[model samples]
Target: MATDQEPVLGIDLGTTNSACAVVRDGRASVVRRGDDRIIPSVVAAMSDGRWLVGTRAKKRRSVDPVNVIYSSKRLIGRRFGSAEVQEMRQRVPYRIVEGKNEAIMIEAGGKVVSAVEVAAHVLTYLRQMAEEALGRRVRRSVIAVPANFTDSQRSATRIAARLAGLDVIRVINEPTAAALAYGYIEDTDRVIAVYDFGGGTFDVTILQITRNVFEVLATSGEMFLGGDDIDEAILGLMVGAFEQQHGISLRDNPVALERLRAVAEQVKIQLSSQSGAAVHVEEVLPGQRSDLDFSLREADLRPYVDPIVRRTIPVCQDALRCAGLSPHQVDEIVLVGGTTRLPHVRSIVEETFGKKPQTSINPMSVVAVGAAIQGAALMGSLVPMADGGVSAPSAAASAVLLDVVPRSLGVHTLGGYVDFIIERNSAIPLEQTRFFTTTTDNQRFVRIQVCQGEDEVFENNLKLGELVLSGLRDAPRGEVTVAVTFEINADGLLEVRAMDKETGQQQVATMRVLGGLDDQEIEQMATRMASAGPGPSSRGGTVVSR
Candidate 1:
């Protein structure tokens, strides 16, 4: 346990921006780097062999497009050979090359780095900012991730936090964290649906809150969906219009595309509040031969934005159906993520749920605030406040969080069939065991192929890893039996173990999951970062470059 004075920070490490907050005395407030709470999740490679994070890094996107890496979250925990990675390679300006163990590596600032390393840089910046704001050495934290994030993604997130030198106390789902922030202020029990639409991903979660206890009933999402898609759609429109007008294709120019992406993002945000927005770019093409200037009305943009927003409706419906509830039964619909600020998104949410959504809290900071409250409760330092936020540590100390596994867990059985050990939506901090015997006579080892998904074919789902139980006594077929156990902790991390019931010998096979760095890689990167010293230091008070 930490002293009350040494507070634990809560971090919302987002796809586009990140924020941190803390619970002190009896109140919970977001930690500010001066007056700014949201920090862009961007990193740039500098000519001096150092790195630039946040606003500074985002600024270099136009000038050093090839070396500036943004939206690394989409690449984290993904295989280099995956279709998503190939698509990302085409979308971003930076060079993404395949690395060891099918990992995705980025070529930036004349050096090759992993997605985990890039994410670590952003986390380190946030950690430093929090320490400076609190005037204390911040060590422990609770980080939030998308509710439907895979096992590899979760593991990679933990590794990133470790590299940032923060002890991750827990990793909570973003939707669940939002619900916590909303429900912490009140004592009533209710069923709520959390719609978290962020810059790079969309997630819908249905949870039943009984006092302080939050139990997730169902969760569903599309990892490739979010605000970025809308931006890309708008960019597509601009490119087509520009090519038609200028008779030149700007698709091959990385720098120009980067600039256009920035512009497209701005236009999207502008259209949210106004009826129309002007899109203009001077010297958009090389040799100063081409430029673009156009006017886009909200009605024009709706054709692109509407389809993207509507895709979330089915996902929300699926989650509700899985939870055995209807929209009318939900007590509240909480809108989270910066993308929720769009009027069209808000209107669609209301239309889907038949109730007005709650947006009283800053959607960007709500997850971090809830995480901070959870951290304080875990530390036994939380105190009641008059602001209708979380109550005292004594009252919160009894609060329990019951989460669920987002996907199914299974093993490959005879004939390429999937034998599910634990079904999706099963409560967390749970364990289930199944027995297996050798298919052939005199077998000495059993190979266990573990996976996550709802697919019936063993190879169709995401392969988490494999475990091998050896040293088994050679015997006739079906003579030897081993018990394999799959356990998911409260934080939603999975671990597997195998035991030979006949010999009482157990072996825990290493799970070679993707999306995170191994111990050796992490240690080497940490040492390199330490020897390289820190990047250019900028106080949090700086204006947002976006």
Candidate 2:
């Protein structure tokens, strides 16, 4: 058992909102600053050398669209030329470009910055708020990530935290975090499904809890679909209405469209709380306010957002089938994500699983709270395990987190087939080694392509990173036994190394990140921070507070 005095902080870094909490006296409570349980995950850089976050940063969106940053979570861990990146360009307001080493870049105030820096700015703000609330340096935390995030994506997230001055003890999958937050701590034997539909992403996970062990059976998700998609769908409806009413297409006008989109999002949120809300847009056309008296009954709103909800059904079926179970076998269903708050979401989920979904815990804050619980466990404040899986009697202890490979770990073979070394669902904090020979005579280099996903074809999977071993002496094609080891740490990210077995010589190596920041990009971000005036403390405006 850990000492009772220290607390473990749990953080939920979300696409639309972020929250933090700490476990004290065996009770978990969200750490609140003011009356907000959720701080809008928005950021703004003022011209006067100040930075603003949360509600204040959100205020700048209408007037200063060029300076405000929202929906940045989509860019993290993605390449500048990826399909997602191409789609984001047409959807979001900011400029998306290729930075050094194929890293995604965003332009603001005449400076180019990497996606990680933007994420760090938001995290740093959260850290400061938590430290101020706790009145001490909050050094340890358990952060949550989407269940389907890849190795490079997870690594980029950790790097963002490092830049934000946080020491993340571990990264828990969002659904698992929600399960922990829901008090799945008893030695109850049951299978539970977590339906996570957040702002920008959706994930469904099936877990089996036995003897206090939470084993995730299967996971599936759609990266581009979430509550945000619902908002976009409604925005399209609003735009169509405007175009029909007025002979002008608002889509061609960026500023007006951004404003209307923001309002459309608010209307969608309002529908969740109120049975009917008047959807109103300001000055959609100069001197003409676009006014549509919109009254949405629970029955009416269902059709518009139902398609979005329906997308999750197949994913759920896939997860259950992968776990070798039927819907009848699942004992409990839990909902996680802000979008789940919508009444239709629960009804559809219950109807699908034939069980009342657990709603005692707030979906939005569950992940963060669970992260704190895990954080406390890892900090030796909740459990006695060490960071490296040892035990300690006091504060020197750490918790052992045994995560699984969410997807198979593999390398590209000669004919484009993926050879799996350690398959998916294998116990983590583990290592796998493989040996190979040079393909051609006097081959001075051996190339390794690391990939994630289940597809046999290389193009169908997610290419995470690559490693190349060079400096081999002139020899026959099969002369050298190049031993390569791929190790996945507790964070579920990969690191690779290669060596010559015969000569015991370490080959020159480099991890070719499929979509990662390079030294040049990192330096440019540093310079941009110096030149872009002071960061705003918080942006200065308020919408009807969520």
Candidate 3:
């Protein structure tokens, strides 16, 4: 058990599964429930108006597909009109409807629920399990997210943590956390590449690790690519085979397709360690007694998996090129995520790195353990683990971590173009101030449109929101000057501030975010959750607030 007077927990909020860990007496360990170390990241609504999380909830995916929400991570913080959400609506058995401000809402349990609430329930469950295992009150945590998660996504995650009654002290990228978990413990100073292939996302990060400082050199990833896509590929094979064998298609039958989806996931897992796996489903057709039986060989499966695995190679190359290193230049490579267990995937990684990647550690829980180390470090108790691996004892005792902004932040300028304030890969907890002039005479306030991306064209970048800076002195065009400052914290959350250049007065910054909940909405939801006294209930936030 950890010896900290008040232990801080590190949580890996993964798409397929989640885990929590803590560092005690300088050794970081995962907080498990008996043998149930990993919790399925699924939530379901029972008929009695109660809720179920983890394994029980995941089991409901096929039985009560509509009431069960799996892969909600892919939908959270995304707009309803987005290509990803629209594609998901047609793919999943559950209903995804457009709520107020185009936010994605899930229709489950005969009522509508926001994606934030679904995530809160999952976070709540993770917190409860941590408290139970540690035998203490756990009020603070460090949550790990993907490297490329947007500002809105990060904000949504923090709100979820608050609703779960845990204060998120810090938010670190998954690959960065994994690197930390590996670096400070080993005491090695070298360049490393972290290939994180998770349930819903794929990312590659190159880092330069010093004795106690870790700096992210370059990072690139696909927002919607990973194990889920692999499952879909395998699922496609099963559907095609079943349709060919029984002369019936299961694609139109959602319930039947749901059953097949479960089988598809199981087959993928089974094939991970074996050369072949059998797929058997009884009564796979609607109102028809038809058994679908088939066996998939590793060689045969590779052809289907080839395309998905190939997509990651270019992404790796891109990161390496950006980092100004060759494939053979990196000192070491580490793989993170459950999806990395596939044999072919490992072989591809081996081919890329010119050596077999490290596999001794549990990829699923490694990120959480690393996060726990960071949590301990933040509390000023972290040091080299009891095993005694890291060197530079003095520097290791007080480690420092540095991260970079994933994408560029800018504002929409005249002629529908972008004027970048902070470029991509710039260090975080950073701020840049640029002065702007009024476009029209006697303009009392100027509306500054904030966006995120690298494109020079306004329409090409993502419009985060607009910040209104008021109380300006009236002046002629291009006369009154306003200084706008863009700040991104360590967690990559963006905040803007404006000031009058002439008088040096701080002006009010009113931001109207595009999709996710604002401060007031999140506060209201948190209050409701508190009143309910919380045992896995849902909350909803439909409107956008300023």
Candidate 4:
């Protein structure tokens, strides 16, 4: 068990990369090993039962396409048969399989590994990195996730942290964490928008900052829009050029596609600094004496990627509308995530917010720094940092975070419609209850269909699972009134409780979240990971330059 005396680490477990930070003596700084501040969220298996993580693992993608797993975050906490997973299947070279409860499992390293387990590998590597940098053992941490993450995704992230041997003290939204990192909390009230564009997801959040209180007013996002999509666009051009030259399509070749994907990412990164990037792939056609070469300038890429960048505009408009604010009302715009480094992306953000984005703090590490501030705040050691941030804060501390639910939570009702119990954007740690009566005479039980969405028709909304209220008092129809309460805690995890209205006694109430690992399975994977081997090769490897 971790005690309050232990230092808490703040982690940004991202889709393409991961970073960690901590607060010491009122200053929060991102922890780094030498010049490396962030590690690639990739893992690979060696033939000797050893696992390679981070940059080394990322480099293995071209040679070991099926065994090297990246972008697992998109599938984490998702069903294997979901549209998103199915869509991802077409892009990546790895194998996606269905696990128990339809949870997504990736076949890598000659064995099937759950997304949670793969994420745990990244978390474990991050933990080791933090411990090495801080020169101490830390077990408590605050994690940041995307604003659009559902109950299952958040739960799966927590389990990953548990497997990493760290106790999760809190989970904050990425955009919210970025806002805190900018130290936007001043005496006067101001509205700020966080445009977080990363490798595998994009999110836009509008928040109102008053003194030390950060309240999220509205948020909108797309899970599949980011740098990866841009890479895909570049890959498309490469595939077309290859087909034109060699009269062959590399689209169906996993190895060729993986190799092209790597070069495409490198080209994207290179074009950010240079006028044009030269992409060359040697021996692209198996053992043949063949090469695929190309050159791309920013202007050439703008056509293919501008559409992807513009997709975020409507999402921003939606968030601002939901927040009851206009573009002019926003006092400042803060950019977070690696994808924000692109000039085109920056230009788009400026056009949307009518202001230059904040660039003093590193976009890649800001969220982690803010999360560390929150962790220190929770431990009661928080102070206003030198940069744009307050320490990790406790709920009871002077610095408070007012987060909201991303979607509407409701129950199935008459006419197969949805009865929204808690509307979207409502503040957290709040509870709402609705009374239910039996429909049949001598009814002993009632099953409440719990869902999350704003659809008027029940079937159109997402089915989270059901809450059963049994052992009811046998009475005539409508005589027995059962009070069902839905409570969303600070973590945004749903909890249901039922009570007998007549007897004033608590009854059975449990919510079964779909497309996630159960408690026992989480424990089993944790144990298995413990014995998996020494995680993250200590041998030095090249770190990608951002």
lDDT, candidate 4, 475-508, per-residue tens = 9999999998899999998888999999998998
Candidate 1 lDDT over 1-546, as tens digits, reads 234557888999888899998988747789887787888899988766778888878989889888889889888888787787899899788999998788889998888888988888888888888888888889899999887778888888888888788899999888778877765534788898999898888888898877655667788888778888888988888888889889889899767887898888888888877888997788788677687986788887777789999999999999999899999999999888888888889999999999999998888899998888788767763444567565444455446676778889998987998999899877788999989888899988888888888999998888877778777788998988999888998888888878887887885456666544677888877776665454344643221211
The superposed Cα distance between candidate 1 and the true structure at residue 216, in angstroms, equals 3.3
lDDT of 3 by residue, 337-377 (tens): 88898899999988887878877678889899888878877
Clashing pairs for model 1 are 77-515, 382-393, 384-392
The residue-level lDDT of candidate 4 at 50 comes to: 64
lDDT of each: 0.82, 0.77, 0.81, 0.84
Weakest 10 consecutive residues, lDDT, candidate 1?
Answer: 537-546
> For model 3, where is the 10-residue window of minimal lDDT?
537-546
TM-score of each: 0.85, 0.85, 0.87, 0.86
Once superposed on the true structure, which residue ranges of model 3 sit more than 4 Å away at CA? 184-189, 210-213, 232-257, 274-304, 381-397, 475-479, 536-546
- lDDT string for model 2 (1-546, tens) is 554445666888888889988877556788877787788888766665455678878878877877777778888998777888899888776677887677887876555567888887777667767776767777677778877788878888887887666788788888778877776656567888999888888889998866555667898888788888888877787777777777568788767766776787787778777776676555666677655433446567789889889988899999999999999999888888889988888888987898889998888898888888787666554443656554442321232445678888889997999998778888788899899798799999988888899899876898877788889888998999888988888888887878898998987777889788766656655555434332332332211110
RMSD to the true structure for each prediction, in A, is 4.9, 5.0, 5.0, 5.2
lDDT order, best first, reads: 4, 1, 3, 2
Off by over 4 Å in 2: 1-7, 45-51, 210-213, 232-267, 274-296, 381-401, 440-442, 519-546
